[model samples]
Target: ISPQTCTEGFAYDRRARQCIDVDECRTLPDACRGDMRCVNQNGGYLPEIPADPEPPSYPRVRTTAQCILGYTPAEDGTCNDIDECETNSHHCNPTQVCINTAGGYTCSCTEGYWLIGGQCQDIDECRYGYCQQLCANVPGSYSCSCNPGFILNTDSRTCQDVDECADEPCTHACFNTYGSFMCNCDEGFELAADGTSCIDLDECSFSEFLCQHRCVNTPGSFSCVCPLGYYVFEDGRSCEDINECDTGNNTCTTAQVCFNFQGGHTCLDPLQCHSPYIEVSDNQCMCSAENPACRDKPFTILYRHMDLSSGRSVPADIFQMQATTRYPGAFYIFQIKSGNEGREFYMRQTSNVSATLVLSRPIKGPREVVLDLEMVTVNNVINFRGSSIIRLTIFVSEHPF
Candidate 1:
């Protein structure tokens, strides 16, 4: 090798006897072009290329300096803010807001929202007690609501109670309270299970003693009823026997007497003498001594009248007959002598001097019955037998009670 020729980026070292590489980046300040870095290789120096190989072109105009982004140069040689909001040139999303600063503008989330992880998120206004009853959150906004029985007020944040009674929800009456309502029924009526309807109150079924005789249930009240010879008292709960004789409500003729009892009335003939009998007193008749028919007839006949209810139960003691005068060593026997064709009545001898008239069978009627009850007295010491007859007329009512 005559002179040891080296490459352009290499230098020859005499002592070492070899070409050496040079660090061009450290030795030459302008080793590479603008915006490019320099590197030394084993045989040559290499210039590092940039990502953008070409530089930006600018206008051929004379100016002191260029303004930064989001600003512009003013006529007075000062930087001015580029109002991105007014010019609609901001980088903020459509739902965000843009605010201007000294030399630039900033992007921020709108009202009722906050920036979270570079995205606009709705703020939970309800957590701050923004509404009195209810709240709902939407994108960048919020709303207030009310419960079922309340209404939103004009303030939009407060709640007011709704008057449900204004719609007439109750059948009878309605009462309004805070956030609720109630229903009430009228007199003689009751509230149903549904709480908004009314039903008739069964006053008669509630108490059997509401009426003395019978209870009649009406729409909303009860009435007392009495049988045919009685009337309801002024108190509307008791019954009083009607005196048909005094009230002239009986069907007695001119020759009959009207007799009143507890539930009915009867007509009876005045004391009169039959063919072989003579009237001795107002209620008694005796046999004539000269008449042969009187020999077989009873020694004395007494007239009586009574009233009873229809469908009278059997074995019911209706009347009692006791001998007024007592004779020593004398005993009496009782029998239903006549007018008992159906055998509805019988005589029960309780003692030697007394007898009871019992209903042996049930009798139903708006009718009348005549019974001839006889009592015979036997005196063995006097060796005499005498008999008395009671002509009793019974009037049965049409009702059982």
Candidate 2:
């Protein structure tokens, strides 16, 4: 009767001139249970049941077969677990690993990465502040580093400084510092350009240092060397006078004396008597212009006691005299001022300028006679007289004792 009635569950109503479903369930109160829904059909109603509240038994109302998360419906109309890892149905990141659970899939971060908010993220292990010196953050780990001239210790988190001078790297002196070292030379040495070896300093070349005579350079020090006549002083930098005379290093003769000066020595010749006045044998004379003569003039004579025995006329002592300027026939007058002991001693002229003495005494044990003799030679032409004095000692003993 109306166009709206052609549709299902619609009926024509003449009072309102519209198509509508009959309210059969509402009018019939005992049509369906309380928990069941009522559905209007073509001139009838249908009952819709709800799920059951208890387990291990079918529901009070029938329901369609469905699958939960990570599961799919099988050919037998039963729920089956799905392998999301293999089927690629998981919603995990590409860098993460997907694993199948009982009814869901799980996501895990790979190596060198971590998981955050169901995604794979790079972990910064350096944020832990475990490194002692310098730290480098890798994906999921950390590394320790050190500065130049240093090395890392056994512990990965800490660093240690290196000592480059421990192995005797320097030729002279080795100095150690933080993370490095240096080579130094002594006072008399210079460091080489390579900074390891040392070179000897030329102390002789400098005018301010070293000895005044000579200078010698050694490995790490210098020495002051003196010349032949000088020696090194106590300070080791200056030269001192070497007393060659006192040290017995001189070659002065017996007649000379050695004198030491600043850098050398002198051999001085001592004084001696002149030619005419002969020097005393085996002795030197200190002669000068003022006093040029020797102190004593001595001559010796010998007489045998057997020859001078009693009643013997042979002469025992003979004396010879000469002058620097002498005439052939000049006569010399002689006088004995001493040795006038008795008639036992007799003196007589033997020649023009010579004399002899005879001892006529019988010596008992031993006897010595000292005589002071004087001679005067006169020149008759001008009446000029010259005199000489002499002192002599004679011994008269048996066997010439």
Candidate 3:
């Protein structure tokens, strides 16, 4: 049998993994498994192993920020764009425009509101500003306030005419326009209610009851009146009365007493007695049979005197008017008081020289003493002759008050 040596000196290719034998005589070979050969490859030392080995790592893809170099994430994890306009914290004069980007801000000129020192500010519209009617400022925009009679409806952004008449722009009425209003009064007469509407005046009619007589109508106004029995007084419209009595208004009856005065006449009492005799009561009286005494001889005379206050007593002298010789029975004298309360009054007395007074039962009301003389004998009427001194005594009950 022949013995072969595994360790030998040679060069080998991986793709063409074939081993090219080394010249053993020129190269020095050390112990490689007891006399092995030594070989070299493109990558360096060669060792005998398997083909198509596993690699150490995989390929990686690059991101945008990462691809563009020098870019870094902020603390918020966002990338920022640098602003050149505000780079050094500087604004480019008053005329330059400023703009802001992702991470920075800028400033520029716009309309209305302005920018100062790179900061935005407001503009005063009330100054000689650009609002046609009125002005209002908001941030970077402007609004309008309509002139007096003209108004702007903010919701519609349109101009509405203000009614000057409605607003009473002038004293009474208003006429409104897009930007203003006017006032006026109409026709022959002035305004009726508002300063705008027209009204008429009646100058041809008697306006005031100017006719002093009956307000007669001629033109605008009028007059005075003179009544039948009156003449024009001091005042233009007043009249003075002319008395009808002076105008002969007296139409009196033949028996009527016509007493005439300044304005009229009156019929008075005739003062002539139509009925005769003396009064015995309120509406009655008696007529005497004879007026003259025939002759004065031994004839009897009886006169009774009565006291009005006391209903029970008579004057002492009248108690003995005549004797009981001819006229007998009794005569009753009644004293008259004022009321009809308790008793009827009468008195019985004898016509003797020593006559006694007798009072009757009491009575009331305006009383009268009845001089009742009667004949006890043959019914012969005693003749009362003439006047005599009759002493009358009055008796009265003391009032209880």
Candidate 4:
């Protein structure tokens, strides 16, 4: 047989030496319709009538070209995009708009959003420096915020300091800083440890001595005091002697004259005792007039003769005198320097204010005697009486010698 080519429906027959139609449906009975049997014909095959599963229904005519809703028909019978954005048949997201393409429609994000993958997502609007302090990106929007110690301004994009010192929280002076505040005290006060309150400062306790001698602390000030034997000066800071004599504040007797000395005073008797008596002490007299009765007084008297006429020892009553003082338990120590007999002057304490001086020998003078007396306390503090001389006389008779 000669080789021959055939089309899809016919085969080359070597016996006939030509191409003829082959009934594929008759050769393969299951090939014509899935619901019916195959019938043979002259050069082709046909499908037998199939019994309807539903009476007079044709299975609702199955279609080969599938198309989505709101689509236009193409020339080859495929579905094409219907431009739903213009036709108003789209249900796209409100934030997005519909876009028509080759065989379907698409939803694209608007100005603030973008199309990502198959969905429309929000774009980050905060990337455009929308806030002055802080910016937050949200679902299609953005917000502004402030850092600590700041508040959002009226514009909703800028920030401002919160002014934390406005309430006057400091107890004394308040100073407003950049974002905070500080408290301070005045010159004489100090800030407390807690830094909120003020307290008074005691300068007396800190300074070595606020006063010259003695210091006293007041609420906000200090004072100075003078020690004993001194007086506070006009400046109230220094000490000075009082000069009791000049001030007439002394306790000396009127019979005595007051003399002022540094921090003290002295009193002096201005008159010697009248005659018929003789001066024996700075302030007293003894009766040297020849009267036995006067000599017999409880007190002692002293006499000094200008001449040594009689070798007879004069009466022991001839050399005693008294000096008075103001201090209790006063002691008198008489000091005399004449001849060796000057040592014989003795002083005695008879009372708080009274003392007696006696000599071991009567004064026989052609010589001068210096006498000193000191009035002192038990502790050796000198009080009053001082030193002076006494006088006497001698009767000279011729041969009566």
Question: What tens-digit string does per-residue lDDT give for candidate 3 at 210-273?
Answer: 4333433222233455545455567655545445445555676556554532123344333331
lDDT of 1 by residue, 1-401 (tens): 11246545556787887656656677887877766666554333466665666755532222332344667767654457788788887788766688877657788987888888777788888888889999997666779999888999999989999999999999999999898899999888999999999999889998877887789888778788887678889998887888888989889998987787667776767776876788899888889656778776798889887878778787899999988778999999899999999988888889889999999888887778888899988899999788889988888877665
Q: What is the lDDT of residue 16 in candidate 2?
A: 76
Cα lDDT for residue 175, candidate 3: 63
lDDT string, candidate 4, 203-263, tens digits: 6687655555677766446677765546878888766666677788988898887755333
Tell me how far candidate 3 lies from the true structure as C-alpha RMSD in angstroms. Answer: 30.6
Instruction: List the candidates' TM-scores in order.
Output: 0.70, 0.43, 0.25, 0.35
Give per-residue CA lDDT, model 2, range 158-259, as digits (tens). 778788887899998899888788999988788999989999888677765446556777766678777666677888876766778899889999888775
Model 3: ten consecutive residues of lowest lDDT? 61-70
Ranked candidates (lDDT, high to low): 1, 2, 4, 3
Best by TM-score: 1
Specify the poorest-scoring 10-residue window by lDDT in model 2.
300-309
Give, for candidate 4, the lowest lDDT window spanning 10 residues. 392-401
Instruction: List runs of model 1 lying over 4 Å from the truth.
Output: 1-72, 84-95, 124-130, 166-171, 191-219, 225-228, 248-256, 262-264, 288-292, 312-315, 341-343
Go through the candidates in order and give the clash count of each. 0, 0, 38, 0
**1 against 3, candidate with superior lDDT:** 1
